[model samples]
Target: MPINLPNNQARDDVLAGRPALWLNPNLKQDGIWDTKLPVRPSRVSEAESNWMLIASLLEKCFPELKATGGKIESALIEVSPMREALGYSSSEFGRIFVKADNDLPVAGSIQARGGVYEVFMYAKALAESQGIISSEKEVDRLVSEEANALFSKHTIAVGSTGNLSLSVGIAARALGFQAVVHICSEAKDWKVDRLTRLGVKVVRHNADYSGAIDLARAQAEADINTYFIDNERSQTLFFGYSAAANELASQLSKAHITVDDNHPLFVYLPCGIGGAPGGASYGLKAIFGNAAHTFFVEPVQSPSALVHMMSGSSEQVSVYDAGMNNKTEADAIAVPRMSEFVAEVMKPLLSGVFTVVDDDLFRWLWIAQTQQSIRLEPSATAGFAGPKFIVNSPQGHAYLEQHGLREKIANATHVVWTTGGAFVPEEQFTKFMERGASLVKDS
Candidate 1:
């Protein structure tokens, strides 16, 4: 009788169809259950999890999300030989395969950690809920003078199906704004000619990626200084991707790594518009509150948040082949329906993983290019080969022997999160050749 959602007979047994998410129930291990709260602010500081208190809450509340890599606390650490070729025996995989920052600036897809703080805090909360006040002190004096407001008021709007809409159209042209991407004509005229060479304004829309977010919400309701920064239906893009789950819990506490709640942990995120695992499962359940085990991957021709979790309905997340509905080469975990906050927090805190084994994600991208040469494409090793293809299938080894995960899959030390990088340096030999086969189209 529990089902959830303020249970009026579990909201009429979820509109009379039932399956109100695994028929609710489990989640009571001893803590956090006050009718199952959304709580998470005691004594605070989940190491300011998604980092720099979300880049100082988009430079003091959305001053036109401009950037030339001004904030991001270290992101490259699969240290050394791709951490022994994804054997990943902890040591937080040496600060998660960090590079020398190899300067493409707003490039290396983790969608610039929440697409440049949800387009500078949702364009300063829609300019203080549309009153404006000298455009919110010229967006707080162009974000306390970090400058680069590229002749300012650039007018923000994003609709992405790839790398957070080309990393919020290069952070709205490094903060002066003026982006307009709205994808889904099966994008990739080389990422729409690299978002019109970062001047942005690429609008395609045959519909997929929710019909390029319904033409970017009808061009943000016919523009009033456009600010529709929806990376799948923003909670300000999970307050800017909870800063990559606060940089994976501050690099797993600088590799001291201690997972509690009966040693709980599991993350195989790769969902479209589900902003990098719904802000890394709300900052790892606000730091392991009920332990945590989030999974959300979809690519069997865009299952669309697994058909809106077997159909609970707020309708949106189906793929009717606008060109085989952006045929999953796994453009950084293709998204369509997002912001039901990952279907109400991955329904009872997580467990949904699917990967249509593109020959086991291009054989784990040529076994990370012959063990740690690190080529990684095939959607950057599908979140590190989606928990080693669900612990080697047969219903993922019988749900890992009814949930023990067979000694962490015989001590592989489970942590497969290589969620894409090395953008287009031969995108894993052109994600199985197309231009080499004359830009596909039997249609």
Candidate 2:
């Protein structure tokens, strides 16, 4: 049955998570993507310092990272071939880049940046107060018996669909914190079992991501010893994610890619509740100013952030309100509701948002693997459709004309931020790939 909703037609359509493109009418006119950053650069720098500590800790504690000399950051692999397969023209889109946070070390997703950072921030603060880690060198203390004992006295908890839980649970358990992950019902069983094997408490909820988050918040409030990693409202998480822009900027500079009035940059990020994309967009805006056009991509079944921003409802409206189930194979980004904090911050920072159907994700996944030797999970593949949509879609053309971006289109650089996939169990990833292959064969 089609959903009969009680909003205006546009709002109803958005809430239903129909595949669509929406330009932010509230985007600042005089300075494109030039808004006051939600968080300060100093705060972002602090998060970077924490990552340095984490790097040191990994060197001393984990043999795997230590063997690689503790190189914690993932590469921004260039995938111009993948872009060509996706129908991006080199003459029009200039070039295509892929920021492969999908291959991030440890937790193997973009969430590793924020999720692990939040856990580290919490653990570091508690340890510093107890004089357990007085210096960066003492970061190794986290893996020590005494520090583990201290961490065991505190509990770290979060709610996630999958990726964020892997990051938080793995890091928290490594540091000996009693980690509790409240997972949405749709989360893969492999993720749950992996966390359980790490000795983290995995609590499964028979509801959507929002419901799981609500329950996790209540539980954290009930226990003083429990420190909740608030995905929706954590500035720490946002700043941790914001740090990526600096690294990306360096990469672009090294490649001789310029972002200016003539050479514009377009970034496509896959979004869920919007923390990671929002933070990254904020940082990119700060770095590239008017030269960067940032857009978020979402699954058609759960375009939570776009629907909220477009309708001006923020957290008050959900996909369910439009009679949508918020179900999709992109489990990591299957959020029903947008984070109010991110929605506010993203209003001025984003260029636009677009939603893609599950079939589109699978098609691109197949194309990427066969044509470009690149493989990504369904959620990560959301950004693969961005360049084509921005250049070819009617709504996209209108947006460019309205924003005076038509002239710069020829010199635009598109970057697709692939969010997560590396840690997916081989069998699970094979299943995703098989589905993608079958879809391609049928087509």
Candidate 3:
């Protein structure tokens, strides 16, 4: 609660998504990363070795979330139709495509997986610290009974770019918590209204995602009873996302992809608030050690993280642990600040580099449609945009050759991670289904 939450006056009129005449910074030669984040110790821990934390998750978080039934549902497709242009399929690897059915989720956001687990984890931890439980398990079971019994009595708050925030509201409601999602005015009014109808207290902040986050964080600090489930910064949230990577690795096993030492994986993943990649990177590296390589992708327009990486003031890859700032977006992946862990725990994960892509987001959408058969939102495309830009660039092409990046991925598999926008309305879907097709007549 350092800075005051600006009044709601004229906040409703804040124009977002438009390019501003802000001071521009150099985009190459470690400019963004070096300027924004100075190197720090990695906060990520190695696999299964952190039993105390794992046990805490079981005792404090999962128990309640499990009791509520699967709040984080999965949606699966036979293959992403959009993958057609890219030329890949589940059939390529011999009929092995066991994956999380993300389309089955209520909000079409995988963040639901982490959000629910985070709430109970916080509750369990708070209770334990307050002497409600001498150990993690007591709080774990108590969280289940307590969450189910009076979930509605408590209020949960989150700041998101549609998916992550929406997931928090839906999961909170199911678990009996009064959900509140704070969003920037630049977000689609339709999505904001939908949240309101769901009984989620949707607060439209004058600023972008980062501004809303500042508001949410301040509010959470002031009110003890108000539980905040930050998909952006909390330690528990990382563990939650690690589950997704774990499941993905399990699926890769069915494809005969040996995830062993020397056969390490070079995963190019999406970053939004740096939660998924940070947590997943930590998890993969922990379990696989030298057997895994993870590359984080950010949007060129929203290079807050890259900026931090280059700056000397910050300790990690993001500013979340410190605070938030004015934010820009590719929408879904827009975040002004990031979890401090990205600097500390997730810092050692510099095994791979970070890259941003051009604005061919919609093209990637069509690519998703034609190739993998999944219609991802523009923000989702931001993830793919990174690798696409690299492979397409002359310098990047040379770098790839120099680093042997083009080496035919041996038993190598890639997950583009179409991260959000799974539930586009019928009108939107119709538009997506016919995005770039030409009419033909054979008279």
Candidate 4:
């Protein structure tokens, strides 16, 4: 069977690498769990339990975790100033909040949610197999000299454009494991420098993200001591990210926000290969059911998830197949293709996807800093345009009417998940700010 996308301008725009919105025609309001999903909701609680078990070891490894008592979590900030700067009134777009993962403790990005958790999961499994620790007790002895010797024999490896490498490398090294990161040409110099400073082996590839991942997987398969963190098909990574929804639920309760039918919730996440956003959307759907609407935001030139999902193909599809160049300044999310595991899991759960131009990302980055004192990378700022796209576009309005949510718009809750930037060097961040400022002035 041939894959048939919608014969419309939106499809044409996506193929041309222009900004557009593509709603999931197969999005379901019920029976989401009827399909065999890749990661189950029960695994989310398991991941939470795993985090608690390793909390002590994390605190022992990083002094920064002492403030949060070894909890790797971020704040949910209500963004009144930034919302206003974006030209949206509360009545028009409801309440807007920034899930400030950029300020998260470990990797300073959303990758901290999955990348760190997956590394911890691996460390725990390795220890259990060696009889170094038991599930009944805390992992206090993980930093012992004997345990470190055991970890030294193994290597944790992954392929990334940038942020995931930082998250995995930092966590693996902190746990006394040898860490190797295979990064693509698009990866930023600052990320490579950070990994090198952490004593992580950095393998530079002159190819794209998929090529780097291919090389990493092949090398890991050949080495008995190397454990590859497969971004494209890791159930551990998916569940690790899904666990974040529990934290979001608790934060929403504390903030006195409602997400019932009368008060819909809309979450906009910046997507790369789609593991983080796909896991997040799946978790949100499990918690809020029909009340939560989750969308993935991507760069126009690298709409990997959007293009693949829109095609409705069982085989993996790359943005290049749709005539996109797979080029963008949002290097962190410059993925040519999305994870097939994520696509299958999100086919029913995801509400929609939208694309943004690079210029708009910079403009939003400037607004986030000047208006709210929130620092973020270009990729992190992708979600800032989500609310506007949903409220103003024809497809967005049609979606609301189709779902009987037009009247519920004023009572909705919008969350823009900010992905990364806390560890950005002063000089690099200064350059980002300068470019953003120039874009803002010209606009």
Among these predicted structures, which one has the highest lDDT?
4
lDDT (CA) per prediction: 0.54, 0.81, 0.53, 0.89
lDDT of 1 by residue, 1-443 (tens): 11113333323332432211212233333444343433343312432433443454354433433451236533445545645545654453222333222222355555666677667556555444544524534555434333433325547777766667777887667656778878876565677787788788887877666667777888787977777776655655664555455456666668665565435455656667675666666666666765455666556555455455544555443444112243666665655455565566545555554545444456556556555555444655556644444554354565555566555544222345555555655653665544213322221
Q: 1-443, model 3: which lDDT tens digit per residue?
A: 22221222111111122211111122222222234333211323322223334344443333443542433434323344444444344332212121333353556655655665576555555555556568744544544655455555668898887777776776566555788888876576657777787789998888767678888889887987788876556776676666665556655675566765324355555666777677666666655664555556655545444445434234433433324333433576776565665644545443433444333555556655665566566566555543333444443355445445555333434445566666667676566445433211110
| Full ranking by lDDT | 4, 2, 1, 3
Report backbone clashes per prediction.
Answer: 21, 0, 55, 0
- lDDT of candidate 4 over 1-443, digit per residue (tens): 23467797679878777778889988987777887776677777887888787788789888999998888899999999777678776577999999999898889998998999999888878888899887647477778887789999999999999899999999999888999999999999999999999999999999899989999999999999999999999989888888788889889999999999999999999999999998778788888998999999999989989989999988888888887888899998999899999998889889889999999888888899998899999999899888887889887898899889898888889999998999999899999999999998987
Off by over 4 Å in 1: 1-50, 53-59, 62-113, 118-141, 144-176, 185-202, 207-242, 247-262, 268-270, 273-275, 278-294, 303-394, 398-443
Candidate 1 worst ten-residue window by lDDT = 17-26
Give per-model TM-scores.
Answer: 0.31, 0.92, 0.70, 0.98
Per the 3 Å backbone cut-off, how many clashing residue pairs does candidate 3 have? 55
Q: In lDDT terms, how accurate is model 2? A: 0.81
TM-score of 3: 0.70
Arrange candidates by TM-score, highest first: which order? 4, 2, 3, 1
Query: What tens digits encode model 2's per-residue C-alpha lDDT throughout 162-240?
Result: 8999999988987889999999987989889899999999999998899999999999999999999988888888988
